[model samples]
Target: SRSLLKLLEAKALIELSNQTKPPQGWPSSPARNLEIPPNLNPDQANVLQLFQNQREQKEWLLWGVTGSGKTEIYLRCCIPELEAGRSVLMLTPEIGLIPQLLERCQRRFGNAVVPYHSALSEGERLATWRYCRSGSPCVVVGTRSAIFLPLPKLGLIVLDEEHDSSYKQEAPMPCYHTRDVARLRQQQEGCGILLGSATPCLETWLACQKPNNSIGLLHLPQRIAARPLPPVRVVDMRQELADGNRQLLSRPLLERLSGLAKRKQQAVVLVPRRGYSTFLSCRSCGQAVTCPHCDVSLTVHRNSDGHSWLRCHWCDHRDEIATNCGQCGSTAFKPFGAGTQKVLEQLELELEGIRLLRFDRDSTRGRDGHKQLLERFAAGEADVLVGTQMLAKGMDLPKVTLAAVLAADGLLHRPDLRAAEQSLQLLLQLAGRAGRGEQPGEVLVQTYDPDHRVIQHLIAGSYAEFLEEEAAVRRIARLAPYSRACLLRFAGPQASLTASAAATLLNHVANQLREADWLAIGPAPAPRARVAGLSRWQLLLQGPPASPIPLPSEQILRRLLPKGVHLAIDPDPMEL
Candidate 1:
């Protein structure tokens, strides 16, 4: 090795090596044989026509059902703008979707598609930035952070999956949402803005309802080829236990999986959480083992070799699994809930011939991990895929004949107002992943509260019905859509400082609220009361629709905040 190194060094000494540089400018060649689809559905055609003719419409919301051709519409809308010598910025919520989106865009626009995200190396990002500044028309697809890019002659902005909470940036000053920022940009540039989603955020829906509002709504109620939505079967866990069946897979789901495996089809099992067991609890003392850094219990995780550990979801802190109760020193502990790992293990045991693949945070840790796992599953390497909420994103897997929610009860009982709405959207989206091909699809949702509103809505497959009921409740309660709300969060290492700061802010806001139309909710603990060793508290303020109220200035508020306490202001946060 030393001789080889000496030889290589001597060879390099003859001439200094040249440093490689990133590619300059965009691709010169046009897209290779890119052609438009032969035809569009009537709903799709109508929406495209409206967008093309109404150049005056600054903001438009496209509410399409899952599996509907929203991306196609976005591509179609960009053609005219690109041809007119204008650029387009398209945003999605996840980095996992970037590769697929980039591929689609490249097929049509070729090298004009520049991807902007944190994952890009500094040189790559700088090159893309320089290329965008060259006054040439191109398409950029990226996550929320892409909204800040300086694209000259920007003609159109598209926010695909706009309802996703990932669009919101919580950290840093001037916290804002991409959808809102897109609207602001549309106003400034006189460019068309399009927000597409299967489940529209309530605020956007309400804006569309306003008679004088500038936002317009376009609906695509049918999937391509008029394929019927998969039939959803709601399985009551209580009945399953009563019938002497105690397993992650409900009876219907297990039967469907067996059938799929026999027929050489694929399936996806979704669990909202990622660890093996949700948490460990002492059977003797009935006390749950909680995280040292956070208020929540530590989840149980297992490796391929079967060693178990406790991990906090919020802080990513890990520790050894407790063999005995910490408080009473009793050697009686049990797992209380299930996550992706547990479901994966159960499926391996229950379905003998099934080739199972786990697709969660742990399994997808390496670079390009998501793409590899998805491709493996897509290639029919796995008979069933088990994962978390990441599986519900806009993944187009056609061979998946079955999709199952191992536990829907966990999603239904969140402390947030959008719980039911989110739950419905997740179920519908997961179900939509199946039956995309010639074979019909089936969905099985197992939940303790089978009669819950979210479960019932999923079973009925009626988003409008669910939204109407939720809207009425929000109206009566003066929640979002009926009013405007903001969350002020304070977190610090010291609990007293966090609490006191939160209380002081709450009182300050309360004193400013003279009219009954404005209200302040609390200076109470945040839903995630403590995370990463920081104690958290929050205060929520709500104002009536169309009402302007005076409040503390950002500068004054920051100066008044206690030292060591960090403040984050989220306007219209998806969660409280």
Candidate 2:
């Protein structure tokens, strides 16, 4: 029955195979009339020429700065492939980016452009699948899952914003990275692979530096129309406190908002978290409110009716707010950190008649939520757009003149190997959202630690220098680009049982590694030890540079673990 269903989904079998008179062909639409092309700048033309000159190269990297016409280059490269009766696949990091990209591609290629993502209905996905299998040349603008589409006569694959961690899937079984899959497909189909990014990942950067490497490199250092990069100013929050300003909005940021309103301009405010507050704490005993099913603090969320509750971010558990402290029976409680909701409230109180729209996960839940809110903002209906990291992913808003980060300390203090690199990429991308038009722009970052290396690099607008220093540091530590790592995760209902299972697996792996050049660490509790009533533990295996980590078969691994435990294997994990 399972095999039959698979065949049906793949369009290999019909409803009645015995009495078949051939199925009707799907309807096709004619392509729209092509519009006059925009004249390419010198840099963009040079990059396109490099691509044309190296048509046989399988791998290429397009390293361009923000607003440097990278998409123009992509569109120019697609014309020749489509004209030659071959297909093109353009992959973006987020679904929210699809609408704009789809619009652009359709404007140029008309009916040949197809959009695909997880939000589509089952019928829509099935139709798209059948269309791709029809052997007609077309272009697919989609997210990660679209990589599996059966694109016959595939000619080129483009990955935009390649440094984004969103390209890696971490849940369920068969954890995989889209970049790796693209490489495999390129080898099988003999297609060209182009990776375009403002800030490339360390692995890709290192790959392009090897002697006699096959991957070609291209660069675009200047922004379009000779616009200068926005000047970043770091605001010291400690000094603001010493001067007796107790509001969440720093004085400098407040003044800028007022100025923007007076000039009738737009601004984007980036908050690290989305709820009302980070967590609630008892004023008397200093005990933070926690989730019963998980080992992490519960964030406070407030609805429009002024009702508030506690929610566990990892497990989706909800509970009523506590009136009295569980530890000391105290009645006083306070929120420790501010989020998007709290920032919205503070902005309402400080400035009158200021139009604001929330752009985080909570607000954008409907089918057309992202498109609607973005259209409203772009049409000059909102003065300020408050959001999370979604606002930083290559959104080209021309009217936005001020970009502010409310809490830089939160992004800079993460406990991970690529924390600094990720933080810098995010901040730079956020800054790129501003100063994209005729008017000059400015960025204001609020941080307690003004001297942090991330902030210093952001202020200087020094991407190359930062990458060089970071590479040196990673080399000394023998981390990524220097070595490869694989993570083994274990989970069970009981902490002791999970630990025991992990220990057993660790012993098996240790014995295997005794004869190889590999390092084994763990059988320890994971960062968030418990989630959704399950205790979690992990083991890490590191292999030498450019070497593959040898893992046991799935059957062998399952037999090694206990009955009540679950195991997951992740290679090239985005997070440790």
TM-score for each candidate, following the candidate numbering: 0.93, 0.94
Q: Give the TM-score of candidate 1.
A: 0.93
The true-versus-predicted C-alpha distance at residue 21 of model 1, in Å, is 5.4
Clashing pairs in 1: none
Clashes of each: 0, 0
lDDT of 2 by residue, 408-433 (tens): 99999999999999999999999999
Model 2 shows how many backbone clashes? 0
Task: Compose the digit string of candidate 1's lDDT tens values, residues 189-235.
Answer: 78888999888877788788888867899899988888878998888
Clashing pairs in 2: none
Candidate 1 lDDT (Cα, 0 to 1)? 0.84
Residue 538 C-alpha lDDT in model 2: 94
Q: Model 1 off-target regions past 4 Å?
A: 1-31, 507-509, 515-517, 546-549
